[model samples]
Target: MPLTDTDRGAMLSVIGASSVDDLFVDVPEAARLSGPIAGLPNHASELAVERHMTALARKNTVAGEVPFFLGCGAYRHHVPASVDHMIQRGEFLTAYTPYQPEIAQGTLQMLFEFQTQVARLLGTDVANASMYDGSTACWEAIGMARRITKRGKAILSSGLHPHYVSVAKTMAKYTGDALATSAPTLTAETDIDALIAAIDGDTSCVVVQYPDILGRIADLTPLADACHANKALLIAVVTEPVALGAIRSPGEMDADIVVGEGQSLGVGLQFGGPYVGLFGCKDKYVRQMPGRLCGETVDADGKRGFVLTLSTREQHIRREKATSNICTNSGLCALAFSIHMTLLGEKGLRDLAGLNHALAVQAAERLAQVPGVSLVNDAFFNEFTVTLPVEARPVVRTLAERGVLAGVSLGRLYPGEDALANGLVIAATETTTAEDIETLATALQEVLA
Candidate 1:
C-alpha cells in the first residue's frame, strides 16, 4: 500500500496540498521532530528490540503492583482466569465477521448472548453487539439522535467527561452539527437542570453522563421527560457500567439511548485499550443502531440458530442506506465482557456492586479526614471527588513516587480550569483493599501537609 511517486502526486492534487509536509501544517513547528528520534535507532535486532522495550516497560508502575485507585472511564477489576481461558480457544480467538451462517454459528451464538446480556444489563429493549469504545459510541448515539429527531443542535451536559465532549466537538466540526458545550462546574447547580432548560425546538439531543466524570450521581427521569417534551432525545453515557447493578438503569429512566464503557466487568485496563463499548436503546431505534446485532431464529427442523440480524455499516450495505461508515465491534473485548457477566450472573453482580460502594464509602470517609481536604459528592457509586487545599496534580505525582497510585486529578482532566484545579477524582472497586485505602489516606495527608 505504500504510495508510488505518481500516486503521491495524484493524492496531493486531490487534496490541494503541495507536499507531505503541507498535511502537517496544523501540527506546531516546534512540536514536530526535525530529524530522527533521539536514542532510537533506524534498525535493530529482534533481541535488542525486545530488551529495549522491556526496559521501558519496567519503568511504568503497573496498577496491580501498587496501591492503585485510578478510574475515570477504564477501571481495574478482578477478571477471572476462566474468562481468559474461554476467550483464547482457537475458534473464538481467530473468529472474524460472521457472514456465513453455516460455518459461523458459534461466533453468531456468542454475539447473540452478548447482545442479550448487554440489553438486560443496560435495561434496554435491545443492545447491539458493541462499539469501538465509550467515546465513539457516544458520538454515534448523538448522530442517531439527529437521524431520529431531524435536528442539528445537540446540547452536552457539563458533567459529560471532557474527553467525550472533545471527541463530539471534533466530529461536529465536520458534520455541521451544532454542539453547545461548556466547562465543568464545582457549584451546586446540577447539569440535568441546566440541560433541561437549555433544550429548544432545534435541539436534536441532550447528552448526560450517569455518575458523571466527577463521580456525582443524579436522577434522570425529569431530564428525560424534558427532552421528550422538547422533541429531543435523551442520551445517557455511563463510564462505569458497574454502577448499574446498584443504581437505577438509564433505560428504565426513559433515556432514549444508553451507551457506556464495558471495561469494569471482565476486561483488563490493558494500559487504556481494547475496551468494549456497550450500546443499547429502545426497540424503535434498533434499525438505526450502529455496529451489528445478532438475532435468534429456528431452522427448518425447528432447531434454534443465530444470525446477524442487522449490519448498518456502509461496508456491509449500500452507502446511502448505511447509518455509519465506520462501525465495528471490539470482538475480543466484547467476548471477555460477556464471559465475565455470565459468570457474575444477576445476584453476584449486585453483591459485587455493594462491595465496591462500601469500600468507596470507607475510602471517602478516610480521605475526607485528611487536613485541608473536603468531600465534594454527597452521593456516588464506587467513586467520589475530594478537594485538596493544594493543587491535586502535583500531590498526585508525589503520591505516585511514594508507591501509591492515587486517583485521577480534575486538573489533569480539565487542564486549565482554575475552578477545578484542586479537585481529585478517586475510585474504588472490589479489587480495592482496606490497606490500599489506608495507604492513600495517609499518603495524601502527608503530601498536603
Candidate 2:
C-alpha cells in the first residue's frame, strides 16, 4: 500500500515542487543536519535494543543505591507504597483533563481536593488545579502580579534557586518586563535590606524563596510589609512544600501570591521532573490566576459534586483575553500529590517534617567535624549549606568515586562564580540515615585530606 517514487513525483508536481528537498526551502541550509545522527545502531532486534538500553541505564548511580544527600530543588523523600497503589488505579491512571464536568466527576473531584490541600498547606484563600512545575508557576505568578498591579518591574531575591530565576528571566525577555535580580548570596542569610531597597513605584512583585536555595529559612513578614507599602505584590516561592508543615505559612506573612514545587511530596525526582507546581493566591485575585480551578457543588438531588470552576486558558476563552497560554493542568502528578498528602494528615506531615529536621541536624553536626568543612546556615529546616576548603565540584566527583553520593555543589548551580565554588548544599529527609551521614563525613574527610 506504500506510494512508489513515481507516485511521490506526481504528488510533488501537484504541489509545484521539484523534489522532497524543495519542501524545506524555508529552513536555512546552515541549520540543517548534514547527515544521519552519529552512534545510532541500524535496525537492531528488540532483544538487542533492550540490552543496549539496560546497559545505558546501569551507568546512572541512583539515589537509593548510595549515601545520597543531593538536594537543590528536586529531592529524595520516602513516598509511601499506598500513594503509588492508589494513583495507579485504572480510574485515575488513564484519566485526562476533566473538560466535561458531567462525565468527569471523579477527575474533577480529585482536582478539587488537590486544590483544597494546596490552598490549606500554603494558607492561601484559593489554589488552581496545578501548573507545569514550580518554575513555570513562579513565572506565571510574576505575570499575574503585573496584571493586578499594572506594573512592569519584578525584584528577584538572591537566594531564589538559579533554575527558577532563569525560567522567570526567559519569560520576561519575550514579555518585555524588567527583572531586577540581586547578586547570588553565598552566606547563611539573605540580604533583606537590599531586596527592600530594590522595590519602587514600578515594581509589580517581589519574589522571595522560603527556605531558599541555600536551605536558610527566612520570615517574609518584613519583606511582605515592604512590598505592600510600595503597592507591589509579594510572591513567596517554596521549593520544598514539606517545610510548610513546620514553618509558618506564607499567607500568614501576608504574601499576595505563593508558588512552589510539589515534587517532594508524592512525586519522585524522576531525573529532574514530570513534577507539579503548586499555585495559590488571595481570593480577590482568583480571576487573574493561571491554569484551571475546580470547585465543589450540589447536584439536583442535593448530593455533592465537583466541576471546573474556572478555565482561563486560550483554549477555553478568546485568545486575546485569556489569562494564561498554559492549556492544561498536571492532572496525574497532582493526583499523586493529593493522595500522598491524604495519607499524611496534618499531624503526620508535621511529624515527618520534624524527623527531617532531626536527621539534617545529625548530618550537619557530623559534617562540621571534618577538618576543612564549615557550616554556613545558623538556622535551617531539612537542608543546610557548607563551605568546603576546596572547590566542591571536584570533591563531589571524588566522593562519587568513593561510593558516596554527596550534596549538590554550588558551583554546579552558579557556574564560574568563584565565591560560591567551595559551597555545597546538603539535604536530609526522613530517608537519610546515621550510617549515610557517617559515610559522607568519612568520605569528605578523606577527600579533603
Candidate 3:
C-alpha cells in the first residue's frame, strides 16, 4: 500500500513541503525518533506478523484474568452468551445505519426499544437513539442547555469525571462557551453546594454526576432547584448506570437532561471502546436533544411500525441548523445493550443491581479495614473511593504486578494535582468474588507496608 514516488512527490508539492520530513516541521526534534522501533521489522511474513501480535496481546493482564477492581468511567460487567450470539446473526450484524425505515424495521424497532429502556432507566421522558460516548453526550447536553437557556456559561461540578470535564473544556474553547471547572477533593462530601452557588444569569447549565466519578452519591434536588430559579438547566451525568437499579434516577430529581455511559449492561469492556452513550431528557427539551430518536407509529395496514423520528445532526440536515455535528455512533454496542436489557428485564436488572451493591459493600467494608486505607463515601451503590496513606499510583502499579487490578488512582485522573494523589476509586460488581476482594486487600496492604 505504499504510495508511488509520483504520488508522494505530487502530494508533497500540493502541501508546499519539499519532503515527508518537512510535514513534521512543527514536531520537536528531540521528540522525533531517529530510527524505526527496535525489534519491529519494516516487513514480515503473514504468519510471523500474526504471531508477533498474539505475543503482544498475551502480555496484557486482562481484567478477567486478574482480581479486577478498576473503574472510573468504564466498568467490567458480564455479558450473556445469548447477547453476543444474537448480535452476531447475519441480519443484525451486517446491517448498517437504518436509513430506509421500510427495510430496516428490525433495526428501527430495536432502537425504539433501546430508547424506551434508556428513558425508563434514567427516569426521563425521552431518550435518543445513542451517541458517541458519555463525554460527548455530556458536551451535547451542555450545548442543548445553551440553546434552551440562551446562555454560554456552564458550571461543571468538581465531582464530574475529569475526562468529561476535559472534553467540555476542549469543545467550549472553540465554541466560545465558558466552562467553570474545579478539581475534585479527596473527601466523602460532594461539591453540590458550590455548584448551586455558581448558578447565575449567564449560566446555561450545571452538570453534576450521580454517584459521581469518585463513586459518592448525593441528592441533586437542591442543585436542580437552584438552576431552575436562574433559568438554567441541570444536566446530570451518570457514569455507573447500574447504580440506578438501587437509587433514584436523575429525571425524578428534576434534572432537565440525563446522560451516561451504557457500557455496564451488555457491552463488556473491549480494551477501551467502542462504548455506547445514553442520552435522555424531559419531553419539553426533546427537540433540542442531539443524536437520533426512533418513534413508534402504525403503518398503512394498522400495523405497528418504527421510524427515525429525529436525526438532528449535520449529515441529516443543514450543518448550521442541525442540533449536533456528531458524524457516527456505536450502533452495534447499543444493540448489545438493548439485548442485555431485554434479557435482564426490569426485575432481573434490579436483582443483578442488588447483587452488585451487596458485593461492593462487602468489598468496601473489607478494603477499608486494611491498614492505611479509609473509605471516602457516605453512600454509594457499587463503586466508591478509598484513600490510602501513600500516593495510590505506585500502590496500583505494585498491585498490578502482583496480579491484581486494584483500582483507579486520582493521581492518574488528575496528574500533578497533589491534593488528590492518595485517592483511589474502586468498583465491585457481581463479577467480583469474596476471594477477589480479599486478594486486593492483602496485596494492597503488603504494597503499602
Candidate 4:
C-alpha cells in the first residue's frame, strides 16, 4: 500500500519528531542544499526525462561503432551470448546478497564457485565474494596486511596504477599509516631491489602490480621473498586478471594477498564502473579479509549446500570492530565473471590469453613501423606503452574524429607528471583484429604527419 500523509505524521509523532527537518537536526544547515539545484529544471515527466537521456546517448559514439583499442584498467573483451542469457534468468538477476543461508543456496553456491575460480586463477587458498573494484580491493589489501602483521608502514611500487596509488594514499592518511611509493618508472620492468630497500621493521606490506600500469609484467618472486624476510606481507594487485593465464600466479611467489579487477573475465567496461574487485589470500588470513564469504556445508537433512560462513567484517558488526564498511558484494558482475570462466574452463582461458598477447604484439609491431612511433615494453601481455614523437593526446583526439578509438594517453593517467605525457599506452584484447591494428597504425601515421 502507498503511504499516506497521515501515516507518516503518526509515525513521526510516535518518535516525538515534529517534522523531517527535526529528524535532520544533527546535519549542518549550511552544508545542505537550500532547495532544488540551480540550472536544473524543477521537475520533468518520467517519459520526458527518458526521451531527453535517450537523445543525449544517441549523440555519443560507443565502442561497438568503432575499432576500440583503449584499455588502461578496463578492456574490450568478448563476452559469450550464453553467459549473458544465463545470468539474466530471473533467478540470478532478481536476487539480493545471500544473507540467509537456508533460502539462498543458489546465490551462495554461485559465490562459492566464484571464490574457487578466483582462488585457482590467482593461485591463492581462498577468495571473498567480491569488492567494489580493483582500486578499493588494493586499498583493502594494504589494510589487511597491516592488521595481520601489526605494522604501520606500507611500501608501494611506482608501477602501480596512479588511481590505485591515490586511493591507497587516501586510505593511509585516514588510518595514520606511513606509505612509501616510488616515482613513476618509464621503463618496462619494476626495480625489485629498490622496493625491498624501502621496506623496514615497521613495514606491514609491500604492494606491487603485476602487468603494471605501463603494461610491464613483473615476476615479483624476489620482492615477495624480501617482504617475507622482513616480516612483512606482499600484496600483489593484478589490474588485468587475463594476464594471469600467461604470467605466473602471485601466490607461487609468496604473495600474502592477491587482489585484481575481474572485469576482463565477464563484466563489460560500462563506462568506468560497476567492475568487480577480485580479492584472494591465504586461508590463514581469511579472518582479516573484508567483504562476505560463502562456504560449503551440510544441512540437518544430510544434503549438501552453501552458506554465508564468515561475515564478521561488515558495517553491521559495529564500526570500531568491523574490518570494513563495505557491506555488499558486486553480486551480478561476479556472476558474469563466473559464468564466462565456467564457459571457458582452464585450457580455454589459456588459449584466450595467448590470443590476446599475439594480437597485442601484432598491433605493437605495426604501430612501431610508423615513422616516429616505438614500442616501449618488450615484456607485456596484451597492453604496452608506445613512445610517440608528438604528444599522444592530440593524436588520440584526431584518431577519434577518424572513427578509431586508438588508445589511452599516459598524460591522462598522470596529468601533471610530464615525463610520461608523450607516451601512449595501447591495449589489444581478443576482440582486436588485424584490421583493427592496421586501422590504428594508419590513423597514427596520418595524425602524426
Candidate 5:
C-alpha cells in the first residue's frame, strides 16, 4: 500500500495544487534549492547502497569492541536478553498506539504497567504513556507548570544538561515566556543555594537535574520546599532514571513534575536517538499534562478494558487551544521500557542499581590512584567527574586510539568553559566490568604520561 504517483497527483489536485512544488509556494525562493545536492550520487540500487553503507559503518569502532566508559545521558547498562526477547514477541512489537483500546488490549496493558512503574519510580501519582525523549519531557513539564501556576517565568539550574537547557530555551522562545538560567555547566557538587536564590514570584517552575551531569546527586527536598514557598513548581529532570533505584524519588521531595529519559531500561543508545521520555506529575495537574493516558474501565461483559480518557486536550479536538501538539509518542520504545521494568520488578531493579553504584565506586577508586587526577565528588551513584592535570579532550582521544572508549570530556560538551575543560565525566553501569575499569585506568595513565 505504498503511495503511487496517481494517488499523490490526486491529492495534490484536490488541494488545487499542480505539483508538490506548488505546496511550497510560500517558501522563500532563496531557501528553495535550484538543483539537487552536489556531492551525493543521483541514485543507486538498493543492494549497492546497502553495501556502501555497510562499508562506511565498518570503519567506526563500536562500544562492544573497546572498554567502554562513556556516559553523558546514555549509559551502557546491561539489559537482560529477556527484555528484547519479550519486546519483539510480535504481539507487542507490532502493536501501535492504543487508539482503539478494546482491540489494543496488549498495548493498553503495557501502557498501564509502564505508567505504574514510572509513577512508583518517580513517587508521583500519575504518568502518561510517554513522550519523545527526556529533553521534550522537560519542555512539556515547563509548559505544564506554566499552565497550572498561570505564570510565564521558568528558573533553570546550572547543573542541568546544557542540551536540555537549550531545548527548554527554544520552547520558551516559541511561547514568549520569560526564562532565567543559571551559569552553564555546573557539576553535581555545584552550589544549589545560588540556584534557589534565582527563584521569584513570577517563576512558574524551577528545573534541576538529579544526579546532575557530574553525577553528583542533590538532595532536592529543601529546594522543593523553597519552590513551594515561592509558589513555584519543581520540575525535576532525570537524564538517568536508573539512578532512582539508589536515590530518593523526586516526587517524595515535593516535585510537582518528574520527567526523565528511560533509555537505560530497554532502549539502546542507537546513536543518541529513539529514547523514551518518561513524564509523570501530581494528580492535580493531570488535566494540564501532555501526552495520552490510558485508563481502565469495565465493558458490557463486566471485563476490565482500557480506554483513551482525557484526549480532548490534544491538538485534534482543541486545535490552537490544545494543551500540546504531541498527539502521538514513542509507543514501541515505551513498551520495551515497560517490559524490561516488569522483568526486573522492584527488588531486581534495586539490585541492578546497587551493582552500578558499586562498580562506579570501584572505578573511581582505581582511577584516583593515577597521578595528576582527582575525584571531584566523593558522594555519587554510578557516575562522577574527574579533574585531570591536562585537558581531557586530547587525553580521551589518545585513549580511544588505544581501543578504550574512555568517558565524555567536558571540554567537548562545553567548548570554551575553562573550569570543566580539564575534567572528564565517567560512568560505570552493570555492564562495566573490572577489566574495563583497569583498561581505562591503564590507558589514562599512559595518556597522562
Candidate 6:
C-alpha cells in the first residue's frame, strides 16, 4: 500500500502541483522539518505492529483484575451483556447524527427515550440528548445560567470535584467571566454558609456536588432557596448517578439545573472515558439547554414519530446565537446507558444502590478499625474520605504494590495543600465484594503500620 515515487509524482501532477513542497508553501520554511524526524522507527509489518501494541497493553493494570476502589468521576460497575449486544446491532452501530428526522426515526426514538429516562432520573422537566461528559456539561450549565440571570459571577462550592472546578475555571478564563471558588475544608464537609455568603447580585449560579467529591451528601434545598432569594441559580452535580436511586434527586431539592456523569450506569471505566454526560433543567430553561432534544409528534398519516425538536449547537444556527458550540451528542454511549437502565428497573436500581451503600458501610467500619485512621464524613453515599496518620499518596502506592488498588489520594488532586495531604477518598460500588473489601483493609493496614 505504500506509495512509490512514481505514484506520488502522478498524484502531484493530477493536483497541478510540481512537488509536495509546493503544497506547504504557505507554512514558514523555518517551521517545517528540515528532514525526516529523528528517533521514529521505520515502517513495520502488520504482525510486528500488532505484537508491539499487544505488549504495551499488557502492562496496564486493569480494574477488573484488581481489588479496585478508584472513583472520583469514572466508576467500575457491572454492565449487562445485553447492553453491548443491543448497541452493536448493524443499524444502531452505524447510525450517525440523526439530522434527517424522516430517515433517522430509529435513532431519534432511542434518543427520545434516553432523554425521558434522564429527565426522570434527575427530576427535571426536560433533559438533552447527551453531552461530552459530566465536566463539560457542568461548564455548559454555568453558561446557561449566565444567559438566564444575565450575571457575571459564578460561585463554586469547594466540595465539588476539583477536576470539575478546574474545567469551569478554564472555560471562564476564555469566556471573560468571573469564578469565585472556596477552599476545601478539613472535614470534607461543604461550607454551605460560606457558599451562601459568597452570592451577590452579580452571581449567575452556585455549583455544588451531591455526595460531593468526598462523598458527603448535602441537602441542596436550603442552598437552592438562598440562591433564588439572591436571584442566582443552583446547579447540582452528581458524579455517581446511581446515588439518585437511593437519595433525593436534584429537582426534588429545587435545583434549577442538574448535571452528572452517567458512566456508572452502563459504561466501563475504559481507563477514563468514552463516558456519557447527563444534562437536565427546569421546563422554562429548556430552550437555553445545550445539545439536541428529541420530541414526539404526529406525522401526516397521524402516526406517532420522533424528531430533533431543539438543536441549539452552532451547526444548526448562527454561531453567536447558539446555546453551545458542541457539534454532536454521544449517541452510542447514550444507547448503552438507556439499555442498562431498562434492564435495571426501579426496584433493581434501588437494590443496586442499596448494595453499594452496604458494601461501603462495611468497608468504612473495617478501615476505621485501623490504628490511626478516622472517617471524615458522617453523611455519605457509597464513597467517603478518611484521614490517615501519614500522607495518603505513599500509602496508596504501597498498597498498589501489595496487589490491592486502594483508592484515590486527595493530595494527588490538590497537590501542595497541607490540609488534604493525609486524606484519602475511597469508593465501594456494587462490584465490590466482602473478599475485596477485606483485601483492601488488610493491605491498607499493613501499609500504614
lDDT (10s digit) by residue, model 6, range 158-228: 88888899899999988877998865876746778889888889999999999788888888988999999
List lDDT for all candidates, in order. 0.90, 0.91, 0.91, 0.88, 0.86, 0.89
In model 5, residue pairs whose N, Cα or C atoms come closer than 3 Å (at least 3 residues apart or on different chains), thus clashing, are: none
User: What is the clash count for each candidate, in the order shown?
Assistant: 0, 0, 0, 0, 0, 0
- Candidate 2, superposed: residue stretches over 4 Å from native: 1-19, 30-35
Candidate 2: tens digits of C-alpha lDDT, residues 59-95: 9998898999989888899999999899987666733
Residue-wise C-alpha lDDT for candidate 5, range 1-449, written one tens digit per residue:
48999999999989999888997889999999888888888889999999999999998889777798899889877777888788877556743566666567777878888999999999999999899999999999999898889999988887788889889888888897788875444344665687688888888988998978888887898888889899999999899888889889999998999999999998888899888999999999998888888888899999988777766455547676678888678888898889888888899999999999999999999999999999888888899999999999999898888889889998987878887788899999988899999989988998888
Evaluated against the true structure, the overall lDDT of model 1 is 0.90
lDDT measured at residue 416 in model 5 versus the true structure, 0 to 100: 84
Off by over 4 Å in 6: 14-18, 25-38
Please provide, for model 3 over 109-227, each residue's C-alpha lDDT reduced to its tens digit, 9 standing for 90 to 100: 88899999999999999999989899999999999998999899999999999999999989998888999999988788999988887888999999999989888889989999999
Q: After superposition, how far is residue 333 of candidate 4 from its true place, in Å?
A: 0.9
Which one wins by lDDT: 1 or 3? 3
On TM-score, the stronger of 5 and 6 is 6
Models 1 onward score TM values of: 0.91, 0.95, 0.92, 0.92, 0.92, 0.96
Candidate 1: give the clashing pairs: none
Cα-lDDT of candidate 6: 0.89
- Candidate 1 matches the true fold with a TM-score of 0.91
Candidate 4, residue 167: the lDDT equals: 95
Show the lowest summed lDDT stretch of 10 residues, model 2. Answer: 90-99
